[model samples]
Target: MAGFDLVVRGGTVITASDRGRYDIGVQDGRIAALGLDLEPGTREIDAESLWVLPGGIDSHVHLDQPQPPGIVQADDFLTGTRAAAAGGNTTVMPFVAQIKGESLRQAVTAYHAKAAGKCYVDVSFHLIISDPTATVLGQELPALVHDGYTSFKVFMTYDDLVLNDRELLEVMEVARREQALMMVHAEGYDSIKFLTERLERSGKTAPYFHAESRPDIVEREATHRAISHGELLDTPLMIVHVSSRAAMEQIRWAQARGLKVYAETCPQYIALTAKDLEGLNMEGARYVCSPPPRDEDSQKAIWEGIEQGVFSTFSSDHAPYFYEGSEGKQNPKARTSFRWVPNGIPGVQTRLPILFSEGVSKGRISPETFVALTSTNHARMYGLYPRKGTIAIGADADLALWDPLREETITQSKMLHGSDYTPYEGMRVKGWPVTTIVRGQVVFADGELKGEPGFGQHLARELSPYAKPGRPS
Candidate 1:
C-alpha cells in the first residue's frame, strides 16, 4: 500500500510569510507533512525547479446570478470555476444578489440552486444587499451572518442599488451587531449622474467619455465618505476595486489614523489605461467597468500602495460580458450611449499570470508579496486562512506548481471562460501554472483540465478575521 495519497517533491515552497525548498505529503485530501524529504506515496509529482505556492484564492468574482435587463453574464458557476482552476485558483467567492422584492433568504436559496453541483473549484458567497428593509436589517441579515454568510457588499452608486447615508448607517448597524464585514462600492452616484447628464447634453457619449463621467474626484469623495461612515459606526470597512490614486489616498488617510479601513485594487487598475476604453467606435465598450481605469500616474500609485502595504488584498473583480450578440457588450441598448453599456470585462483566468509577469517577474513586487496579495491576505480577511490559503501540515492540499520562465500571449481562444473576449487579449505574460492541485486532486495539469463539476464544496465563513478588541481603532 502507498504510504501517502500523494507527494510533491523538490520545489521552492513559498508562502506569504515563509519560503524554503520542501517536500509535501498529502493524505486523505489534506497536507499531512512538509519536510526536507517525505515518504513515497501512491502518486508522485516531481516539481524540480518549480515554484510551489498556495493555490490562489480569488476573493472577488461574479458567476451566474441576476443581472439587469438585456444583459447576461457569459459564465456561470461551472464555467467560472473551470476558468478559476485553469488560472491556478483553488477557491472563488462570488456574490449572491438580493433583489428589491426578494428576501435575503430567498436570494441565498436561489444562488445555492444556481451553484449546486456545478463548480470545479470551491466557492463562497458574498451578499449583495440591494434591499435592506426593516425585517432584513432586523432579523434576516443577522441570522444569515450567524449562519456563516459573514461578509456582504453595499453599493453607493448604482441607481437601483445605491443606499443613502441614513440607509448606509442602518446597514452598518446591522453589520456591527452581526459581526459581519461590510464592503463598499465607493463612487458617488450623484456625481456620476451629474457628469453623465452633462456629457450627454454635450453629445460626448462615447466609451471614452465614460472615463470622464466618473473621474478620480468621484471615487475620492466617496471613498472619504465611506471611511467617515465606517468611523461613525466604529466598524471595519473594505473599499473594493479601488482604481484611482485619490481614492487610495483616502484609504491611506483612514489607516494612518488607526481606523480599520482596508482597500483592494484590481489588475485593470495596474495593467490597463483609459486608452483601452477609448478604442475607436464601439471597440472601447469592452473596457467599460465602473470606477474606470485611470492614467499611468494612478497605476504607479496602485503599485506603490501594493508595495507599501496600503492595500490589504487584490482581486480580479471578474465581471464577464461577451462582446457579441444582443445580450452581450454590444447590445442594442448600449450602442447609442456609454451609460447603457454593461460595465465589466472578462479577466478571472489572466489575473494571476498578468500580475506575476508584470509585478513579480519585472521586480515590481516580491514573490512573497505576490502570494500575500493574491492568496493569503484574501484567505485571512475573508476567514478562510489556514484551510484554503496556506501550504502547511493540516491545511487543504491546494497547490500551484509554476514554471516561472514560461511565456505566452493571452488570447481569447486559449482561455476557458465562456466569454468570447478577454481584456488582456494579445498581451504577453510570464510564469504560468504548470499544474493546479485542489484538495490533493489534480484539477489542471499542463494546460489540460482534469477535474469535473460538483467537485467544489461551499465555504461557510466566520466573522471577519480582522475583527478584534477596539477593532476600528
Candidate 2:
C-alpha cells in the first residue's frame, strides 16, 4: 500500500529552484515528499507531458467595488472566485473599498460580510483608503494593520479618489508605522483634467480621444511623484497598472538608487495599444482605462521589463463591469465625454493563459520565473508566504496541472468572469490548466468546478512589507 494519500507523477515540476521531472506525494493536505520510485499512495494522478506549478495567487481583484455615479460592480464573491479557480488560481486578494466619509472599520466589516463563507478558494483583501481622515489615519488604520489588513491602494487621478500630497503623506506615515505595503495608481490628476477640458473644447470627445486626454507624460510624472513621496517619508511604494515605457523607466531609475520602489504591469499595456480604440466604436469604451495602452515601442519595453527582472509581482487588477447595462461602458451617457466610461476590463480569468502563451511558449521568460511572479514573489512581498503560495512541506496543497499540449482559442463564451466580452478574444493559447487543487480538495478538473461555493476562507494578515512597522491603519 502507498504511504501517501495522493501522488502526482510524469510531470515537469517547476518550482523556484531546480526544474525536472519529479513526482510529488501529498498526505493530509501537505506536500509530504518529493522523490522517485519509493512510495505508493491511495490516489494517483498521471501528469504525463504536463507542467505542474503552484496555483496562482492574484493580489489585485475587485469583487464588489463601489464606483462613480453610484454604480456597483457586476461580479460578487462567488462569481469572481469561480473565475479565479478556472484560471488555475487557488488564492486571490481583492480590495475592500472605503466609501467616502465612512469609517474604515465599518467598510471592512461590510466587505467581510460579503466575502465570508462565499468562496471556492482562499481569499484576502487590500483596503482602498478613499476616506483617510485624521481620525482614520490615527485610529482605524493602525488597528486594522495589526488585525491582518496589511496592504492598501490609493488613487492619484480620479476626482473623488485623488489624494493631494499632504493626504498622501499622512497615509504613507500610517503605512510606515504599520509596516504595510502601499500601492499607488499613478497618474497626474490636474494634468488629466486640463487635457480633458482642452479635448472637449476641441470636439475631441470620441472614445479614441480618451487616450489622448492622459498622455504618457502625465503617468510618468505621477510615477515619479509617488516614488519621491515614498522616498521623502522613507516608505516603500508600488506603482500599479503601469502602462507606458516612461512610467516604467521612473520606477527602474528609483529602484536603481536603492529606493524601495516597485512596479507592476498588466496585459493591456503589453498586448493592446491606442490604435485598438481608434475606430471609435461605442464598444471601445470598454478599453478606456487610466494610463491607456501605448505604442509598439512601449510594448517592447514592457516585454523586456519582464525578462530583465523589473517587476516583482503580476496581478489581474480585475474590475468587472457589465456591457449594455445602465452603468456599463458600452452605452455611454455622455457620448463625447471620456470620463463617463468604465475604467477597467475583465482580466482575472485570462492573465495566466496570456502569460503562458507570450512568455513561456515564446521563451521570453523561463517557466520558473513565471511561477515566481504569479505566485512566490507575491506571497513573499505580501506576508502570505508558506501557507498560500507554494508546493512545499507544510504549505497548503494548492496546485495546478497544466497541459502544455492542450491548445485553445480564447473566447468570452467559455470564460467564467461576469463580463460580456473578452479583451483577448480569439488569441491562441498553447497550454491550459487541466486540474486544480486547493487545500487537498479538487476545485476544478477537466473544465468543471468540483468544489462548492462556500469552501473558501477569509485570510487575515498579521504584518505586511507594505505596512509601517507597528502602526495599525
Candidate 3:
C-alpha cells in the first residue's frame, strides 16, 4: 500500500516568504510533508517546470444575494465557485447581508440555505451589518463571531444600507469587544448624491459621468473618515476596493500613524481606466462599478501600493450582473440614467490572470509578492491563515499549478462564470493556472471542472490577522 494518498512532484513550490523545488505529499485533504525526495504515493502529478502556489483566496466576492426585482446576479455559489476554481482560487469568502428589521442570525441561516450544496470550493461569510441594533450588537454579533463569522462590513453610502457615524462607532465598539475585523466600503454617499444631482441637472448622465459623480476626493474623504473612526475606538479597519491615488494616500497616512488600517485593491483599478466607461452608447454601463476605475495615474498608484505593501490583499470584488435585458444593466431605470444601474463588475475568474500577467510578468511585482497578495495575505487578514493559505505541513492542500509562459487572449466563451461579457475580453495574458487543487482533490484540471457543486464546505473564521500584537484574543 502507498504511504500517502498523493504526491505532487518536481515542481517549484512558491510562497510569500520562500520558493524552491519540493515534492509535496498529501493525505486525507491535508499536506503531510514536503521534501526533496518523498516516499511514493498512490497518485502522482508531474509538475516539472511548473509553479506550484497556494490557491488564491478571494476574500471579497458576491454570490446569491437578494437584489432588486429586475436585477439578478448571473453567478451563484455553484457557478461563482466553479469560476473561482478554474481561475486557481481554492477558497472564496462572500458577504452575508443582514436586511433591516431582521435577525442577524436569521440572515446568516438564510444565506447558509442559499450556499447549501452549491459551492465548488471552500467558502466563508463576512456579515454586512445593515441593521446594527442593540440586540445584534450585544448578543447576536458576539455569538456569530464566536461561531467563526469573525468579520463584518459596513457602508457609509447607499440609501438603504449606509450607516451614520454614530451607528458606525457603535458597531466598531462591538468589533473591538468581540475581536472581529471591520471592512468598510469607503465612499461618501452624500457627496455622491450631491454630485449626481448636479450632474443630472446639467444633463451629464452618460456612463462616463458616473466617474465624475464619485471622484477621487469622495473616496479619499470617506477613507480618511473611516480611518479616523478606527483611530478613535482603537479598532483595526480594512478599506476595500480602493480605486484612486487619493484613497491609497489616505490608507498610507493611517499606516504611517501606526494605526492598523489595512487596504485591498482590485484588478479594475490596476488594469482598466475610466475611459472604459466611455464605451459607445450604453455599453459603458458594463464597467459601472462603484468607486469606478480611474486614470493612468491612479493605475500607477495601485501598482505602487502593491509593491510598497500598502495593500495587504488583492481581491476580485466579483459582483456579477448580466449586461443586457430589463433585469440587468439595461433595467428601465438604468436606461434613463446611469444612477439606476447596479454598481459591480465580474472578475472572479480573471483576477489572477490579470494580476499575474500585468504584475508578475511585466516585472511590476515578484512571484513572492503575487502569492502574498492573492493568497497568503488574504487568508491571514480574513482569519483563514496557516490552514488554507500556505504550502506547509498540516495545511489544507489547496494549491494552483501554473504555466507562467502560457499565453492566451481572454474571451467570454472560454470562461466558466455566468457573466455574459468579460471586461478583459481580447486582452492577452501571459500566465495561467492550469490546474487547481482543493484539499487533496483536483477541482479544476487543464481548463475543466472536475469537482461537483457540493464539494466545498463552509469555513468559520477567527479574529483579524492584522490585530495588534498582544491584543486580547
Best by lDDT: 3
Off by over 4 Å in 2: 331-336, 465-473
Worst 10 residues of 2 by lDDT: 464-473
lDDT of each: 0.90, 0.83, 0.92
lDDT string for model 2 (64-100, tens) is 8777774557688988999999999999999988888
Query: In model 1, which residue pairs have backbone atoms overlapping below 3 Å?
Result: none
lDDT measured at residue 293 in model 3 versus the true structure, 0 to 100: 96
lDDT of 3 by residue, 54-165 (tens): 9999999999888877789988898999999999999999999888899999999999999999999999999999998999999999999999998999999988789999
Residue 427's lDDT in candidate 1? 92
For every model shown, what is its TM-score relative to the native structure? 0.98, 0.95, 0.98
Better of 2 and 3 by lDDT: 3
**Residue 158 lDDT, candidate 1, scale 0-100:** 87
Q: Candidate 2 vs candidate 3: which has greater TM-score?
A: 3
RMSD each, Å: 1.0, 2.6, 1.6
User: Distance (Å) between predicted and true CA of 407, model 3?
Assistant: 0.6
Name the 10 consecutive residues with the lowest summed lDDT in model 1: 464-473
